[model samples]
Target: EPEVTQTPSHQVTQMGQEVILRCVPISNHLYFYWYRQILGQKVEFLVSFYNNEISEKSEIFDDQFSVERPDGSNFTLKIRSTKLEDSAMYFCASSERGVGELFFGEGSRLTVL
Candidate 1:
């Protein structure tokens, strides 16, 4: 089955540096989303994109963050300035049905020093 895939399972970065997390969502999925889990915290939604535009976004998606579909198969998230609080496991998810269950990637772990 097709699945979402994220690169660089772990990353250690310095504060204020920019980081780009990469993801390849399922080929036929119609909805894509980004969520983060702070170590032991519950998953928090960052943004959701559909039809080539943002469908929903949470407060966590601030000026420092951005998302884009750079190609037919890749979905990317860029953080302009890293902060200690930004340390978390960022997961990429996709679903064929808009309201159906989402399939998640293993996640890219971000660590800011």
Candidate 2:
């Protein structure tokens, strides 16, 4: 079975820098989402994308953040300026339907200093 794959499983960056996290989900899945978990905090939703447009987003997805499906096969999340608070484990997920089980990738951990 195909699963979601994320690149650079671990990333270290300085505050004020930019970072792009990449993921590739199962080929037939439709709804894609980005979620994050701060070191000691609960998992939070960032944004959801479908049909090449943003379907839903949380307040955490602010001006500093953006998502894209540059190619049909991969999805990406870009943070324009990093902050210490931005350090978190970002997970990429996809589901065949909008309301079912979401298959997730091994999170990409971001560390900002």
In candidate 1, position 72 carries an lDDT of 95
Give each model's whole-structure lDDT: 0.95, 0.96
User: Per-residue lDDT for 1-113 in model 1, tens only?
Assistant: 77799998999999999999999999989899999999999999999999899999999999999999988999999999999999999999998978979999999999999
TM-score of 2: 0.97
Cα-based TM-score, every candidate: 0.97, 0.97
The C-alpha stretches of model 2 lying farther than 4 A from their native spots are none
Count of backbone collisions in candidate 2 = 0
Per-residue lDDT value at 50 in model 1: 95
